[model samples]
Target: MPGFDSEFTPITRQRLFAGERLRAIRRRAGLGQAAMAARLGISVSYLSQIENDDRPLTSAVLAALARHHPFDLAAIEADQPTRRFAAARAALDDPVFAGSALAADALARIVEQQPAFADRFIALHAAYRRAEERLQMVDEGLESGGGRLPWEEVRDWFHEAGNYVDLLDRGAESLALRLGDGDGALRDALAERGIVVATNDDPATLRRLDRADGRLAISAALPPESRRFMLAHQLAAIAFAEPIAAIAESAALRSAEARRLLAVGLANYAAGALLMPYERFRAAARAFRHDIDRLRLHFSVSFEQACHRLSTLQRPGARGVPMFFCRVDMAGNITKRHSATRLQFARFGGACPLWAVHEAVAIPDRIMTQLVETPDGVRYVSMAKGLVKASGSFARAPRRYAVALGCEAAHARDFVYADAIDVDGSGAATPIGISCRLCPRADCDQRAFPPADRAIAVDPDIRRIVPYRL
Candidate 1:
């Protein structure tokens, strides 16, 4: 039988030792060192040397164990060294070590010589992350009255579900087909159900549902796309009421309000899916090379809608590029966020000011693109656009926000915004952070505060871009 030993080089053997694993296996098998050595036809001293990492276990011994004992050779040879090294690198990249120059070789050596210590450090780092999230919840008033915020709970539910709801999507798509396709097909379907679709001039009334009278009134002030979205949303709530209720019931939310809000969220998701079927939208996205404007026009959806729908293209085998989508208000408050990629937003504060999203807010109606590199060395091709929704009256303030969408650099070739950008070229990408409090970049001139986890050294006499040194 083919064995893993053939894939191992001498350097790999030195880097990865299975001593601890072998000892655990032997102990679990209820065999003493002498007995185990005798079964493997090796001297007791040789077995002791292998268990202590003084000698590498031979392939013959591994095969013997596999043949006669309940041993998992693949488990013993799982590339733990690489995983531990990556974990150590991630931990050391924290703000606590901002100015410390720890090389990759040093981190690898720590994993090799002090694996137990490395494991402890990694676990501690995970605890720190949880603590940070808790602090953020406190700051956001989520910990008030000893209950989690409804919106936050809904957000977490979506995140855990991979930001995709197959049942909702398919149901909505089937309804869309039954309703027929055209500019007035949705309205016709609603009218057939004795649901009067009317528009209101009152700027304050974005949407109102009158179940007693069987009417749905939407604000005439909204854009065409938003108007259609509102209609589709109401349609989903009425047509798929049973399915939505079943899903919400299964959630077991802590509060009735949470359940209600989740129902609304699910209905909205279904609306988006109804307007843009998964397969059609995904194929169009690829054909347009993921140009937001093109997708918006082709799908007859708003720019924000197109961006949000792109983040949900997480179908199992036929998946599109994984992307992160977010919307930030003029005050830098994150109103909506979801990521199918590894790019996670800050749970507490505003996004990094250096990011192009903020700049997009200043230049409304224009799309801004940037190549950004995070502290972990992963690069992304990000695009953002600012939008304003008119209130249709002088007394009411228009809603303003910027929506950002992006994917990892590895998928840049399929992204239109990345066509003229050199994502891999040196000095081509802007260095950005998750947030100031959690960012570990010591030289960032736009840092609003020193990292909360790191110590700050102040020098009144030698002030640079920032007042303190990390």
Candidate 2:
């Protein structure tokens, strides 16, 4: 870079931006682009295009960057890994799975656990996005006529589950619920009442309880945790499922499918409660700091299963933190979320980058704590931890992930991870909200989409630094 500074061109910055950290390194070594591309087993044309900002860097190339230049791809990916999952969601768009809540949930899990596959799916989705965008520009009205987006429903399911299964586990622990022998226990318990657990692989049926054979089958491939949840639902369905449906009957849903998913999800929550008896689980939660992994082992539930149960700790006088939770893979798309709090989180839209939940993806596997205050002065202490997936089998192993949790800052003093929260306490912290779409912080660098209720008013008279002047 010393003597070559004058010879350098725009291509230099382009290559650097495309995950090629070694560009400057190679130049420092006095190697040419042709030489570097030759050593990389790639063509000079591709390298030239990458160098000149003509091409995007794929994960494959980013992986190579890590090997060759020792850069942190996870740090680089802090921008948006959820794009991978959003793409995979586009693949499982078959009407059959789209209509089934179980299939939709499975699709979400797959996308989150297998980002490489998700990336391919996203590329495929990008094509669709382009076509749809072009068609919209041509005729926006025609593009509006379709069934509700399946992804939106699945997103709600996750959010309702509170980002991870830990909240569910916490909720169950409040009651001392335990899923003994996992799915086997639910099946045995159901069999006692003349109900049998069955699998319906056919694309036509999902979660149908066959009374004639006294068997219940789900139409999708369920992970063990989900299977246990479904079985638990069967037991609850026999008793309170009808009652829960009665409740939903009076409520509003985006669609019949969404309503059904919500009803069954509640049934599953009830079943989890039965296994964990209320007072006993609450005692355990008080004993354990609400740490999910320990609760999972104690209750014999999966991490997600445990987290899901934790979100339900609200019952009149007995309540834990009225917490809001969410999970995101390396990408920004919210994979799951849940809230008893008043926060109305975005189900599929991007969250503000400044939010601690979004930052959790960067420090995978370790717990990250933050003291975040909303622009309105409400403060919360947030904690995030990384989780690796294991299916007990090879083919369906899920990818690793990190999740975050936070409670009102007033209650932050009671949590163990609070002391490490990244707060300077001098009020220099960036103001953030539940989602960028809802946040009103005009000076926020992380603002993406404007809040739904606000309109952007641009004045032609003054030159504004930001895109829109409100």
Candidate 3:
């Protein structure tokens, strides 16, 4: 009886890759061990040896040998590149460095150390490419898209995990450091660990550390807030890499490299949060009556940082104003958001044009307020404001945004930003949903992608304000 081989299996292919063919092919040829040994000019024991992978059929043996049976070398090599591609792909699967060359470089490095992780990356990439192709076809079938596009999977992974709060909490409790309001505390702590802190350059853009020079220059590009963030983040990474890596390694994550990177991100976020704990800042913020400008004075944190930290106060029963915070720039791009309350800032595409968050950038340094709601009747009082990162000296320095907060409409009276949004208006709250796929609103100009489930009707009789007829 002839034995049949499965289409694919890692071990089978790897064996053939390692040139283990003597056992099967010689047997199929009905050649006994001694005869096969004579034909290959090797000892009978040597023939047995190569078959068991105990000794290599070195290039010399392979060149002199010939298969006395039917087989297809081309068919066997067909899946070889796919195997290598899978490894290369696995090495590059990094969420932090997604959409950049960093992922590819990371993958190459992984190939040098752990090839299995790299192989998994390749398999995942192939699956992703196929899924995206199918999704595009689905979009084409819709003819046109309107409202928030259904990019739920991409959105949640990129936006939610990238938010840094969860990672911060995990890393902070593990470090067991005392967080206080003093600006010098972090620098002093790092110094105790032989880490010298200097205001040489912004930490993010500083490429490498010159061990010989004993100098740590910051990037002149960063704003004060970003400077503190990058510095604290790096310090945290140095302090907690081992423990964080341990957590990541044991996390049962899809990829091992992702676990390592998550450790870095988690460490950085923890460092920043440790420099500014929730309880202390929340208390100072209340004393100032949630006045962001004044809170920045008390704690050397930026408006956005102060505002963002405020939203994370999920302490039992002593909760603060349960606000939704957003940080945006002049172009209406929502750089980040931390929300405990329901404020629908588009997780994909552009935000609603009618919303004050988009308009706040235009009215620089002025607070823009609005009353918004989702279709299911969750109302919010949102405050949007622009933030200028660099002052007069640093003209080339980038601009940023600082939209302090929002909360349930019922709590609007306590916030100064909700002074005039008219939450009680009978008109529909401009239909907003999470991402385009989840949002069913038709013809919203803010939509970056069309809703996945929108039953868009086209009559051509009336022109919709949005570019798409959906």
- Which candidate leads the pack in lDDT? 1
- lDDT rank order: 1, 2, 3
- lDDT (10s digit) by residue, model 1, range 1-470: 11123322224434445788888656744468997787767889988988998876654454344333321243465467645555566566555566896644455456667889989999999798657555645544431344557887887688768789999988887887777665498888788888999888888998998889988899999899999999899888888889899999899578888899999999999999999998788778877779888998987899999999999988764566778999999989788888876577875458999999998887899988999988877788999999998989999888899999999876665688887888779999999988887789999999998876799999878979899999
lDDT value for model 1:
0.78
* Highest-scoring model, TM-score: 1
What TM-score does each of the candidates earn? 0.71, 0.54, 0.56
Residue by residue across 346-452, what tens digits does model 3's lDDT show? 54344555666766776767876667767546677777677776533443555566574877765544465655667678773455555566566664677666677
Give the worst 10-residue stretch by lDDT in candidate 1.
1-10
lDDT of each: 0.78, 0.56, 0.54
Off by over 4 Å in 2: 1-185, 197-212, 215-227, 253-255, 329-331, 359-364, 386-402, 422-424, 427-430, 449-470
RMSD (CA, angstroms), candidate 3: 23.0
Candidate 3, which segments miss by more than 4 Å at Cα?
A: 1-181, 199-215, 251-257, 315-319, 329-333, 343-346, 391-397, 400-404, 425-437, 442-450, 464-470
> Over 4 Å off in model 1, which ranges?
1-148
* Alpha carbon lDDT at 283, candidate 1: 75
lDDT of 2 by residue, 265-346 (tens): 6666666775655556555654565666677677666666655556666653344555667777777766767665434455
